[model samples]
Target: MTGLAKPQGVKRMQVVIHAGAAFTDDGRLLGSLLANKAALAQSRSLPLGPRHSRQFVKVMSDSVIKDVPVDDAQEDLREIFPEDLNAERLIISSDKFFGPRRTALQHGQIYPFAAKRTAYSEKLLEGAQLELFVGLVNPGSFIPKILMSLHEDQRESILGSTDLSCLSWLNMIDDLGDLAPGVKLTLWENEDTPLIWGDIVRAMAGLADDVALKDEYALLLSLLTGTGKTQLLELIQQGTAKDRQSLRDSLAGIFEDHAQPEQIEEELDLPGWNSDIVSAFSELYEQDLAKIHTMPNVRVLHP
Candidate 1:
């Protein structure tokens, strides 16, 4: 990463930061990850981290969200997290860095939402010792949520001015690359988050496979039906304990058979789309993800 380097005497430092492509994380991942604090204490690979992780990050990066002066922020933050803090890494997340995502504003397909704002946030964080993590969603469902949340007139204005048919988030990711070169990027599809919840938390915390990520199954439980969850647990324990890959295969089979119809259904009940168009947009999104996987120094989280 292109930021302040740690002194030789200190452990080489790293920071894991998640600035959401809005509506993706919603702070739940952070909540679930922090729940592992007790087990994390016993983890050998994970480093000792900030005592109040969420608070420390929020306080230090509040300027990035609120658009305050970076210089003032640097001075004030040092007071709160003096050099004596023993943490080698920090787990930070915020959705606000991308600006108001659910607004009645659209800037067209090529430059849809938060392009400039995201670049600005990166600029604000310039020279900060941190790596970047982001969750991207398909514009297929993303647009509906934004329209639903806005005033009718505002929504109309956005629809009138923007070409939703060609929307893509590749530009936004590219914007980050242009603005913050040398920063490590970790990516995952928002829709697949439940399947890879444990993996995401472990990667974000810079922990090893053995360091358990608490509430790893929390997202799956919320998304799956009661029968599915029970069946999955049974499959996991029915025979002798299975390897991670075997367990994952068993879980996937269960999920495929029993995933709730409502969870799979994407009924916007709003305008500007049909089943075919939505499907096409979704395919395009998958393609975008495939392209992202090919980028150098980028970590694409998987199940």
Candidate 2:
């Protein structure tokens, strides 16, 4: 008996196990089971039997266990376990590994949805913060609500209605609307943009007196254009005699510089010249004098 063929003396061991997380598909669950079995076999020093050997019986059961539908795993595992015996392990470790892994998978799958909810919450918080800041700054006023109610384009329109210099004061209101708590120091400091309309008015008044009328006129024209100058002149033309006299004095230098010298000589000699020359000169003088008188404030030059 030449040892009844040495292979016949080798005892084949077999075990079966089932384990998985709730959402494990068949292939993944099978892979997990094989991995667990390999780990157990490596630890226990067992020669694993073939996965489909009829000599093996199901030794473990779980919700995750199901018959293999196709031959992919069989082909892959053929070389590793050639003996006709199926081996498996208890699914306890498999269940433990997959439980949390399954939960993590589920969480990752729905992560986008959770992120959207977080973003919406952040926007709501931002709105609440903005509202609270506005309330604190305005105290008794409802300007913040009014600003919020307006469309973006309308906000600029409303701002335009107020003076440009007042923008920094308005920004104080805006800062209060959106600023953090420690930013109070910004309010205590003076801004380059002025806050008071009265200051602008006083400056304009000073310019009105200290600057020459032409300079004032040019300044006004530069700021407001030719139509504004025409309107201002029309208004002055409608004023009382005293007001007109003052305007005339302010404007007299302009008119005198533009008057004709021939007209001046003719007007001075008006009552006693040769008739022909006198008539011709008289007509010319009359026309020129009329032109000068129509100006703001030219005086006749005497000879």
For each candidate in the order shown, give its overall lDDT on alpha carbons.
0.64, 0.27
* Candidate number with greatest TM-score: 1
Candidate 1: RMSD to truth: 4.3
lDDT of 1: 0.64
Show model 1 residue runs off by greater than 4 Å: 1-9, 41-69, 76-83, 102-106, 109-128, 238-242
Writing each residue's lDDT as its tens digit, candidate 1 over 1-303 gives 223235667555555667676667667876775678655544322322334444444544466557677666555455434565455565556654454554423565533334444444344444445577777778777777767777888777877878777678777667667766656788888877877777777877777876656567767766678999887667645854367777667767777788888876667756756777778988999898889889886788876
Q: List the residue pairs that clash in candidate 1.
A: none
TM-scores, one per candidate? 0.80, 0.14
**Candidate 1 TM-score, C-alpha based:** 0.80
